[model samples]
Target: MKTKINLIFPMVVMALFLFIGHTSAQPAIITQWTFDDTIEPSTGEGTASLIGGVTQHSATMSNGWRITDFPEQYVGSGTAGAQFIVSTEGYQNIVLDFGHRSSGTMSRWAEIHYTTDGGANWQVLANNNGDLTPHDVVYPFSFDFSSVAAASDNPLFGVRIVSIFSPVAFNPEAPDSTFAANTAYHRARTPGTGGNPYSGDGNWRLLEVTFAGEAIMPGGAEKLTIVDFNGGNIPELNVPFYLTVQTQNINNEPTAIEIDTEVSISVTSGTGSLNGTLAQVIPAGEHTLSFSDLTYDVAENGVVLTVAATSGMVLEPAISEPFEVVYPLENIIAKWTFDDTTEPVIGEGVASLIGGVTQHSASIGSGWRITNFPEQYDGSGTAGAQFMVSTDGYQNIVLDFGHRSSGTMSRWAEIHYTTDGGANWQVLDNNNGNLTPHDVVYPFNFDFSSVSGTANNAGFGVRIVSVFSPVAFNPEVPDSTFAANTAYHRARTPGTGGNPYSGGGNWRLLEVTFLGEPLGILPGDANCDGIVNILDAVTIVNYIMTGNVHPFCFDNADVNSDGLIDVLDVVGTVNIILGRVRK
Candidate 1:
């Protein structure tokens, strides 16, 4: 009994060691050629070629490489094929795999060959030649070269697959003359028994020629990891953010080569979808990938990003840490539709008649309509309509609206805006930075997004009024008649339109809006209640002196934006509340 037990234990231990050794060995990708994008190998180093009379070409059909101009079936056998040359340095247990299919009249049998000296000499793989039975659909084939010690770790290693004639069952020494001549052997032939003979016009298509082996060093990538974010993970809604990804091996190190793989990010947990440049191709010899200008519209919590590679890349998808997408701080400060409502729909504002221009209910549309005007081109730069809106907690103010003119109205108008409560005004210029042409038409947005001192002002206002063209005052005197496109005032007056000065025509306005982005932190509002006052100064002082744990905004406490909250900041805050300074 003791002898039998000892023998069984030794055998069991041997089997265990063999299983562990086999399972530890993983096949690393030495090279791969898909021919989907470039003629170069997809993963590592390799060059493809055609043997004998075969011609190789690239096409988008199934993203495969094609070989054409073959010899007649059963003729030139064991000669025509495709070859892939690669260096298997730092690898062992080499293997070659590919997918191939043939046209109806193409040769069916092919043999795999290898050359350890870079195609100078070749040797046929024993008993590896077989029939490729499928047509159009790919049939997979693999060859193991573990016994060929000379093929491993060789820089000049190469392999090729060639068409070969198969022996007939009755005549073992002769070629199979009827292999592809009958209907059963061709894809497009009729069901009847008789068919045409195989022709050289037929061709073969091959894809995914992969060369793999056990690596002596770190190898192919197994997973992806997000390395960094250009705009941070918790970005504002509708704001663009870029992210970087790295391809990592099983040991969590960046792979040596992550080429030809496409990487993309998808919103796996949020209602919003990713927009703009979602996927990027990993360039040759590069392991890190980057995306550009990705945005989400809706603010939501637990927004997760799933970074994925293409299916053929054989990489595990990665998940990003859950992060929240917050609402954009900027908002519409005030908007007036002038469609039965003259006040702003968003915030505090009012639209009122000014400059002797009265409102009419029924003309071009429901808006502020003006008719009466000073004689031809007289009140050009001095009269029209006015809009007042407060941008108290916002910056980067902009304006948009719609305006129309009657056929008889003046063709030119001046756009005037005030940032200091109408104390001073500046004329908005055309896109060319000129104020004379006034070429702006209806439904336009005037950008003040880059202009300074146009935001957070309680006295902000805008005025659109009549203006005379520069052509009318070429000699410093008003032209007696209106230009070709000019119109008279509300009523026809004598000597208008090629006559003396006359007042005739009308103007209509609607949908005036003021937009701005919320300030990151209101300069003097230490408590962050959307206002600057005495309490803000007191809040700053109390927090600094007593370390009081009251509600506070550190950014607001630094009133001068100098990264400090001391007596100087307190003084700046006081100046703002006392109307002695402006932010």
Candidate 2:
């Protein structure tokens, strides 16, 4: 189980173990310095030896010895090796940040050496040949255990700086004097040449040297602020920072635990608290602390506070752990309908009369009577009456008309559509002669493909109309008597395909079908029959010439099953067409 504690709350949860007494690891501090001037001798007496330096000078430290600008000629002088004792034994890495400030004509070089049995005999670990120029900020030279022999057992080492070729005498005591004379005249002089002195005179400055080692800290209450709300003026805070604590076991093996958390601040009015949360797994190792936040403010100018663990939590070897939360996208389909309650009679010629006619005696005799025809009726008009439909773009308009009575009327019902919000209309279906009386079970389909462009927009509508001949109607005729009472049900299509009666008239709206397989040919269906076969070849050719085939033409034409529709497929199609082979 994972528990999430918001960092914003003032009360921070302390690690359970921190309350009890437990020893942890100590943090490491890496520092570097460059020596360009002469230094005073050591006041305390000890075995002091000059490892390497200019003018044979020497500097002493509590742990080890360092020499600046030392000549290479005195490698094994009297008691020099014995005095320079190696102190860096358990360090894993070292960084040498050194450079020279010179205006000479000679190349400069540096080398690092290691000694196991005192300093009697030395072995070169690394060397640079004229690679670094004077006055250049050479990057910190990082040296790993790979450069040392049996590094785990012998981590102690020494460094040496040498001037390869130089005309000016080098001075470790006074670096500025050698280059000062040539300040105006020899500005373009190369290293180790006249105009700028080298060796004991000037032309050299050592920047910094640093050592990095591992340390561990354990047993403490880790109070981490992921975010802080300074005040109402600056309310929201979102910054992520990492705190790594080191821990060691009885065997002296180092283990680090990294806590990656964010601090956030939400301030209201003048009072605000900082809150934070953990969102990543803590890894084992010597963890380092880093922060990346755009809105962080410190009260003091140069007093950056370094936070440390102080409670129950102790850095130690343990399993990794993590923190996060997970959520999904939401959507819905809404629908609305316009019933007779709102639209009674749509227009002057339209009516919703039911069970009136089975046949046509007159154009307006029965069957949803249309008083007017074509806006103006001529001598027993043959045109039909119109009824309009409005939609809210979401619905696919489908005109459903049930065939209650069967007879050959002078005209058939058709549907018209308008994309311009009823500004103009296009006949979706004109005189649907293909529909037969027996086809009553299946609604007449007019795919909205013809009006998809117009209907895809905001406002769209449909108009249902029936064409009949008023002059052709016979009052005594049985067909005429029943024609006025043609009753049918209107509705929308119930599948994925477009409006089936898009071009047809005399359709009514019904419940929508939200889910269904869209009507079209499946992939590799060449014959346009939803399958691949020899007929597919003929279909391909027909499509190529007439631009009429199923949507997935490429799937059907690529006979070799490759993802391409090229000449090879054409040849394969030709072969299939000639009955040379089967698909």
Candidate 3:
């Protein structure tokens, strides 16, 4: 029941939910009948027929549909009615509304009933016990027709009103179409002559009659979702695949009836989008259609291809969330952008939280400010700057950092390697080529690839450490003169060897990109015009798409070096342009 339902609510007009058989909107008044018809044999407002009922037709009407002979000495039972007939086929949850007043509440209650076989067998619905009397004031009454309709095999229904008033206890249908308000069985308690229906306020009056029902029609259309695809559920980037779509009636309308509705399907973040509408001659229920042929596009690992359904009808189209498709990476193992955010945005690597190493603002991306550089390295501690890199033959560790210090009190950094997890440490690399302390102070790169490992092993790890050096600024304190560390923390005034740190100065490291050996990529750089620019990337795409142009070298064109030329080259080229790769 979406409570009452969906595709149908079992949802009312105002998004209201009903506790009906199915989700649906609340029933509404479809037709009504008010006996204001001045003309006889009235074909009233709701196209209803005034059948066996007393006709008090009047050009200048007074009050309502009434019966006479009330407040008289009692006799046998009497029954009379102004029966209004209407149809209730092809719909359910029916309701009837009527109002009337009478002269006696002492009489047995009147009843409202329905007949499926033209008044043959009457199933009593509601009674008039709640109607007011004596003063003859109009009151209200309601009856739920859900059970009666559900039990019936037929749709044609009739409503009958039977009044059993007076001293008569018998309740029966009026004799064939005439007013029985004065029937011998139904007598009033009043012991005087009761002839005029208008004279006395004790007459039975049927003021109005109306019908309402929920059409049993659906309010929601079939949902749009991805189904039965040829490829495996796991997506593969840049692959051509076909998937059959189970497109049902978007209008959720009963297909038990036929109609013309249009449907369109398209995809976002996916290649080869469809553009067109289809003439879907839908059946009473659910079914499917196929997109036939489609090519999944290559995208950033987590990008999704959203297939959406759009229609120009009462149906709300479906928009699917991101769908997964990916091509596992090769060659490049990890990439980090310390843009202040924890964890790499695109890599699966280990970043140790040691010392006072914290994310700090930098000129580009994010930087790690190495604050209390452990005066010592115990496999961890202040020596830890960022992510750990396990070396395997020529594992390139490229980093961007800044070094700042003053004479005789400057801090120096070194790169060390250990195949035994820091046990047997060795001078793996150094980039302060000039041997100058804190020379390249703000954004420098340590091309660790230039120095190869001693043993071709996987356990080989590398770490960057700092040592204390003395440097004197011409002046210190608020008067300037002291230099800031690579991380940007200035040397303490008077330089008092600030706390546990030899010199309280900040050092910064921004980017650290690691890749496998043989990254002398010119890969993605097809035209080898020195740098791997967008032009080289374009060359590869041209060769693959048109073949008229070719790359200077096939090896170079294999951007990701998957040994294949496709959209991945374009992605790789883009990564290169954005400096996501340093090889």
Point to the candidate with the largest lDDT: 1
**What lDDT does each candidate get?**
0.66, 0.33, 0.46
Tell me the TM-score of each prediction against the true structure: 0.34, 0.22, 0.28
196-279 per-residue lDDT for model 3 (tens digits): 332222346554455667665443444544565655555444455555544444333222222334445556544333333323
- lDDT sort, best first: 1, 3, 2
Clash count of each predicted structure: 11, 96, 41
Q: Which segments of model 2 are wrong by more than 4 Å?
A: 1-53, 56-86, 93-107, 134-140, 147-149, 153-156, 162-203, 215-583
Worst 10 residues of 3 by lDDT: 1-10
Query: Residue by residue across 147-214, what tens digits does model 1's lDDT show?
Result: 99988888999988876665332221122333432222122222232344456677777766778898
Q: How many clashes in candidate 1?
A: 11
- Order by TM-score, highest first: 1, 3, 2
lDDT of 1: 0.66
TM-score of 1: 0.34
Pairwise lDDT winner, candidates 2 and 3: 3
Q: Which candidate has the top score in TM-score?
A: 1
| Tens digit of per-residue lDDT, candidate 2, span 58-88 | 3322212223342332132211211223334
